[model samples]
Target chain A: MKTQSILLKQRPEKTPQNSDFEFKEEEVSTPKSNEVLLKSIYISVDPYLRGRMRDVESYIEPFQLNEPITSAIIAKVEKSEHENFKEGDYVLGHLAWKEYQVAKGENLRKVDPKQANLSAYLGILGMTGLTAYFGLTEIGAPKEGETVLVSGAAGAVGSTVGQIAKIYGCKTIGIAGSDEKIDLIKGKFNYDEGINYKTTDNMKEAISKAATNGIDVYYDNVGGEILDATLQNINRNGRVINCGAISQYNKDETATGPRVEGILIKKSVKMQGFTLQNDFGEKFNEGTKKLAQWLQEGKLNYEETIREGFEKVPQAFIDLFSGENKGKMVVKVAEE
Target chain B: MKTQSILLKQRPEKTPQNSDFEFKEEEVSTPKSNEVLLKSIYISVDPYLRGRMRDVESYIEPFQLNEPITSAIIAKVEKSEHENFKEGDYVLGHLAWKEYQVAKGENLRKVDPKQANLSAYLGILGMTGLTAYFGLTEIGAPKEGETVLVSGAAGAVGSTVGQIAKIYGCKTIGIAGSDEKIDLIKGKFNYDEGINYKTTDNMKEAISKAATNGIDVYYDNVGGEILDATLQNINRNGRVINCGAISQYNKDETATGPRVEGILIKKSVKMQGFTLQNDFGEKFNEGTKKLAQWLQEGKLNYEETIREGFEKVPQAFIDLFSGENKGKMVVKVAEE
Candidate 1:
C-alpha cells in the first residue's frame, strides 16, 4: 500500500512559507506481531509546532530537516495483532503526518467514538482541552470576583480559558485580533468584555478601561505588545500563564519589549511558562477528568474549525499564523 | 534644639542628583505624652529608594516634592515620656532624615547594642538580609547540587544570596561590575566562580563558560542586559528571582530587552518578583529566626560599608546608582 506524507523541507526564517513543507510518497509497511496498522483520521496543527521547527534546545526537540512532521492525530486501527487494540477501534496518539502508518498498539491510546465525536478527540476531549484546563487552573488559579484577561482570546486554548475563567466566577476580559473573534468570545464564551487588538490603538488604556478593577490573572497565549499592555493593568499578586507566544513564533530576529522585572517587582507578580507535555507530566488523567466533567455538564463548550482532506495539513497549519481559525484547528482525513 | 532635614526638592528625570534634595533647618519639638525625642544615629541608604523618588505609584507610596526623605534609621531616645522607651535607649523605625524628630514610641522597634552592632540592624539582621533570604529560599528554591548565579553579586542582597546558595550546597557563580568586587564575592563569599560583566565583551558566553552546565537558578538584582544574557543560559525548570533592578532604576525611560516568554516557556522557567514588605507579612519572624541562627553558628557573614556623618545621607543614596558602596550601604549619624 502507498501513502502521502508532508515533511519539513526547510526551516522557516520569519513567517512560515508553504515552501517550507514538501509532500512525499512512501510505501506503507505491514504490521508486525504486537503492532497495529493505523489509518490517520484527523490531524491537529498548533502554534507550538513553530517552536519545534527551529534548530534550538527546548523541552521538545526541534523537527529534523526533511523528516515527516508529527503532532496529535486521531487514527483508526485497520489490523491489530495486539491484545489491547482491535480492528475498527479509534485511537489517538502523537503520530506522523502519513495517511497510513504501522505502530505498536501500546504507543496509541484507545479512544471510544461513543465517548465523543472522533474529530473531538483531536480537540476538546484531548490535547486542546488539557492545555486549556491545566494552563488556566494550575497557573492562572482564577479566584471569584477577580478579573481574568486572556490574549489570543479566540484561538483553541484562549476560548477555553475565557470560559473556564467565567466558570470560576471571575470577570473575564479577552483580547483578540478581529472584531468577529471579540464578539464570539464575549457572546458565546461568556467573556464579560473583549478588545480587538487590530482595531484598538491603545491596548494598555483599552485593557485598563475594560478591566476597570484590574486584571488578577492573565492567560497569555499571544505574547508581544499585548502581554506588555496587560502588564500595565495587572493588579497586585497577579499570575501570568505563558502558554504560547504565537505572535513571536514567526519573527526572524528575537523581538524586544519593555523590561519586565521593574513591573514584576512593583506588582509582586508571577510569570510562569509551561508546555502541556513538559509541565503536565503525571497529571494528564486528572486534567482530562475535570475537562470532561465540565463538557458533560454543559458548563463547557468547544469549537473546531475542521478542514477536510489529508493533503491540506500543511496549509491548515499555515493558516494558524494568519488568525484564520476561530477555535480548535484540526484537519480531517478520513471517517472513523 | 535646632536640627537639619533633607526634603525632596524635585523629581529626578533620570539619575538622582544632589540638587533633587533640599536641606532645611527646623526646631526640634519637645516630647509630648507617649512621644519620644529621638536623635538619628544610623541611617540606611538602599537602591530601592530610587523607585520611591518617582511620582508614580508602586508597592510603596512615591515621594512628594518638599517632603522629608525617610528610610530605616536607628535613633537614640534623647527625651522620652513613653512607657516602652527611656532616655539613651536605641530604637529602629522608618524615620525621617532629620537629625532629631519626635515620634510615638509604639512606631519604633527597640534594639540592644549588646546583641549586635548598631548598623547590623539596618543590613544583616534587618531588611537586607531578609530580602536575600526570602527572595532565594521562597522563589529561587535552590536544591542541593544545582548551579546558582547571582547578578550584582557584590551588592548587599546579591552577596548574601551567593553565600546562602553556597550554604545550601549548590554551585555558585557571581557576576559583578568590577574585578575587585568579583574577587570579594568569590574569595570572601565562597562563590565557585566569578564573571566580571563590565570587562567581559559577551556576558552570555562568559556566563555559559563560568556556569559550565547551564544556570539552574538566577537571582537577579541588576536587571538589564545582564538579565537578557542570563536568560540565554538558563536550564530546564529554572527559577529567576527578580530582587531589584538597579541597572534600570535611574533610566529616564523604561528600558527594553529581549522578550523572555519564548525562552521561559522553552525552558519551563518561573520568573517571580517580590519585596520585603508586600510578600512578607507574618513571616518576618520565621526568616529572622533562620537568619539569626546562621549568624550565631558562624555559617553566615555580612559586609557593611559604613560612611560617617549626618549631612551625607543624600549623597550616599545618589552614590548607589554608580555602585559606590560594597555590601549594605549605611551612614553613621552620631556616636552611640
Candidate 2:
C-alpha cells in the first residue's frame, strides 16, 4: 500500500515556515510477526516539537533533516499479525506525520473508543494527559486548599494541569496570552481566576489579585516574565513544576534568567523540571484509565484545534510557536 | 560592679573600620527573680553579623546603631536568682558583646565542659552545627554514595556540613579560598576532597574534577561564580541547600543573579535557602542532641580562631568579611 508522509525538507530557522516540510509518498510494508499496519487518524502537535527542530541537546534528541517528524498519533490497525491486537483495533503510538505505516504492535497500545472519543486518544487520553498528571501530582505536589498558578493555562498540558488541580481541591489560577483564551479557560475549565498576560501591564499585581493567599504550586509552561511574576507571589515552601519553557524554546539565544529567583531563597521554594517519558513508562496506562474515567463522568473537558491533512502537520506544529491554537492542536489525517 | 560593653557606633560603608564600633563602661545590675548574671567567656563572631548591621528587612531584625551588637555567647554564671541555673554553671545564650549580662534563665541552656571543649559549643554544638545538620539532612537530602559539595568549606557551617556528609556516607568535596584552609579541611575533617577556588582560574573545570561523579547535593555557603560553577556540575535531580550566600552578603547592592539557572530545567535541580531560625523552634532539640552525641563520640571535629577581650568582638566579626579566620571565629571575653 502507498503511504503519504511529511518529511523535513530543511531545518527551521527561528519559527518554522511551511516550506521547510516536503510531502513524499512511500510504500507501506505488510505487518510482520507481532507487528501492525496502521492508518493514521489524528496527529498531535505539541510545543516540545519546537525543541526537536534545533540541534541543541535536551531531554530528547532533535529531529534530523529529510526525516519525517514523529509524534503521538491515534490510528486504526488495518492489518495485525499480533495475538494481542485485532485487524480493526484502534491504537495509539508514536506514528510519524504519515497517512499509513507499519509499526511493531508492542510499541502501540489499543485505545477504547466506546468509553471516549477516538480523537482524545491523541490528546487528553494520551501523552498530553499523562504529562499533566505526573507533573502536577508528583513534581508540583499540590495539596488541598493550595493555590495553583499555571502558565499557558489555555494550552494542552496547562489546561489539564488546572483541571487536575481543581480535582485535587486546589484553587486554580491560569495565565494565557489572549482574552478569548483566558475567557474560554476560566469559563470552560472552571479556573478560579484567569489573567491575560498580553493585556496586563503589571503581571505581579495581576497574579496577586488572583492569588490572594499566595501561590503554593506554580506549574510553569511559559518560563519568561510570567514565571518571574509568579515567583513573587509564591508562598513559603512553594513548589514550581517546570514542565515546559515554551517562551524561550524558539529563541536564538538564551533568555535572561528570571530576576525574582531570589524569592526561591526567601520563600524556600523548590523548582523541578521533568519530561513525561522519564516518569511514566508502562504506567502511562494508569493515567489514561483515570483520565478516561474522568471524561466519561463529565468531570474533565478538553478541546482541539484540528488542521486537516497529513501535509499540514509541520504547519500545525509551527502554529504552536505563534500561539495560534486554543487547546491541544492536532492534524486530522482521516475521518473516524 | 562595673561591666564593659561594645556598641555599634556607625554602619560601615565598606569593610568595617575601627570607628564602626564604640566601647562603653556601664554599671552591672544584680540578677532579678528567674534571671542569672552571666560573665561572658566566649563570644561567637559569624558571617550573619554583616546582615545584622544593615537596616534592611530580613529573617532576623537588623541591629540598631548605638546598641550593643548581640549574638550567641558561651558564658559562666556569676550570680543566679533563677531556680534552673546556679553560680559557676556554664551556659549558652544570646548575649550582647559585653563582659557581663543579666539574662532570664529561660534564655540560657546549660552546656557541659567535660564532654567537649567549651569553644566547640559556639561552633559545632550551637547554631552553626544545627544549621549544617538540618540544612543538609532536611534540605539537601544527601543519599549514600552521592557526591556532596560544600562552598566556604573551612568556615563553621561548611566544615560541619562536610563532616556530616561523611557521616551520611556521601563523597564530600569542599571548596575554600586558600590552600591552607583546604588542606586543614581535608586533613582534619576527613573530607573526600578539597579545592582551593581562589587559586583555580577555571572554577567549572575544578568543580568537575573534584566532583567526578557529578554533584548530588550542593550546600551553598559562598554564592557568586562558585555557585554558578556548581550549578554547571550538578547532576540530574540535584538538591542545593542555600544556607548562606557569604560571597554576596557584603556587596552594596543585590548581587547579580546566576547565569546558569537555565541548568535547573535540564538537571531538574532544587535550590532552597533557609535561616536556622525558621526550623529552630521545631528541630532544635533533635539537631543539638545529634551534634552533642557526635562530639562525645569524637566523630565531629571543630577548629576555633580565638581573639582575646570583648573589645575585639567587632574586629572578629569584621574579619569574617575578609575570610581571615579558619573555622569558627570567636572572641574570648573573660576567663571561666
Best TM-score among the predictions, by candidate number = 1
Candidate 2, residue A16: Cα displacement in angstroms equals: 3.3
Docking quality band of candidate 2, CAPRI definitions: acceptable
Cα deviation of B171, candidate 2, in Å: 2.4
Model 1, B1-336: lDDT tens digits are 999999999998888999999999999989999999999999999988889999887999998899998999999999999999989999999999999999998899999999889898898889999999999999999999999999988988888898899899999999988989988988878889999887999998999999888999999998889999999999988999998888899885568889998888888899999878879856999988888888888877778789988889989999988888899999998988
State the lDDT of candidate 1 residue by residue for A1-336, as single tens digits.
999989999998888888999999999999999999999999999988998999988788899999999999999999999899999988899999999999888889998888778877777778888888888898888889999999988988888988988889999999889898988998888889999999999999999999999999999998899999999999999989998888889984468988899999888999999878878868999988888888899887778899999988989999999999999999999876
lDDT of 2 at B123: 87
Clashing pairs in 1: none
Runs of candidate 1 with Cα error greater than 4 angstroms are none
Cα lDDT tens digits for candidate 2, A245-290: 7777766554555333345655667777776776566687788788
Worst 10 contiguous positions by lDDT, candidate 2 chain B:
B253-262
Give the C-alpha miss distance for residue B5 in model 1, angstroms.
0.7
Query: After best superposition, candidate 1 residue B271: deviation in angstroms?
Result: 1.2
